[model samples]
Target: MRIKVLALSLIGCCSAMAWAQQKEPTKPAETEVYEPVPPKVRVNEKGIPSDAIVLFDGSNLDAWMSGRDGDAAQWTLNADGSMTVKDKAGDIRTRQEFGSVQLHIEWKSPAEVQRKGQNRGNSGIFLQDRYEVQVLDNNNNDTYVNGQVGSIYKQAIPLAMASKPSGEWNTYDIIYHAPVFGKLGEVIQKGSLTVIHNGVLIQDHFELLGTTEYIGWPKNKPHGKGAIRLQDHRDNSRVSYRNIWVRELE
Candidate 1:
């Protein structure tokens, strides 16, 4: 029994020595993996990398041509670097084409508060000249739910109502994926959009139903490349737009 106990103590000492020799997990070689500098992002609050093209940066509107006859834009340039709708000068659009885009636009209704509903600072940012993600002054005012601020205009209502009072600047950072179709004009991959209205997410990867309209249901028009149009509703709402930029996607 004495010999057995002596052997057991020896074994325990050997095991403890072996364990002590083992270096405790020295904080795994903290090799700093410095990532490469990301690309220029137009509107990526999520820190995603992107390439962008600046349209209007309080500099010039040369990137945009008239929606009427391809001449210079007719909108009046505000002293604050914003461009106001010519009221009856029709709409303006970029001269380029885009498939998927990260769009950032800043706008505001005239301080001189206007009429109510549909006519209250009514305007639109028409993507691909077809899909209209609406822009309206819905502060304490009501209108058609699906056609109000941050709407996919007549298709899907916003996930929330986030509109600043009139005159204050409101912003929209939109990620838009253009539609994809099969041979039979049937939608294969429907377009999706996520909109941030005034730093609030109002549209979250919402599927588009088709082009926006006033008096009818959504329709799937054939796809190709199209311009970005700003609607001039002919209501003299004095819509202003600034900080316009875009980043194309493959």
Candidate 2:
């Protein structure tokens, strides 16, 4: 019995010693990844990337058409390098269709605050011509949170209100992922959007449920690539836009 106890104690001591001598986990090795810089045209001195498609460079409206019936875009193109909304001209959309894309656009509300609430310099940028990223004069202006500037229309509220004062330009840098549909027109993977408004992160990789609607619940309608639509509002808001560009993604 004495020998057995001594043997057990020794075994326990050896095990404890082994455990104490064990080393901690080694850290993973660091490796560098190679990412080549792409070429860019840098038009309008906007620093637009080389792989981007210039939609409007403050020159003309050749890349756009009327969203109502595919007619030519009739918005007033100013010599000041911006396009002003000609009320009653109907919504304008890009003639070229795109799927997933990284889009950059700059807009400014009229210097004069015309109307209040939903009618205050209201406009929108519709991805796939369906999902809306609302544009409004929310600076010192109050409205529904989900329908305010930088919101996804009435669907998703912005994380922050990032709108400049009236007449000041605000930039929207959006990265959109198109939804994938199955064979039977069912959504296999939902789309997502990441929006940076005026250099502020508002929508942080928001998952789009479906098409943005103002009257009813959002619905998923299977559709292919579509043009980027700009709402006219038709209320004489006089919103101006310039320096629009997009980069298609795979």
Per-candidate TM-scores read 0.80, 0.84
Scored by Cα lDDT, where does model 2 land?
0.88
For model 2, the superposed segments whose C-alpha errors exceed 4 Å read 1-45
Q: Report RMSD for candidate 1.
A: 13.7
Clashes of each: 0, 2
Residues 1-250, model 2: lDDT tens digits = 3443344345445677664674532432212222344455454455888778999998789999999899899999999999998999999999999999999999999998888988999999999999999999987789999999999887789999878889999999999999999999999999999999989999988989899998998999899999999999989989999999999996
Query: What would the per-residue lDDT of candidate 1 be over residues 1-250, giving only the tens digit for each residue?
Result: 3443344345445687765675553443332223344555453673333466777877678888889899988888878899988889988888997888989889998888878999989999988989999988888789989999999999889989988878989989999999998899889988988999989999999998888878798889779778988888889989899988887876
Name model 1 segments beyond 4 Å from true: 1-50
- Prediction 2 TM-score vs. true: 0.84
- Model 2 Cα RMSD, Å? 11.9
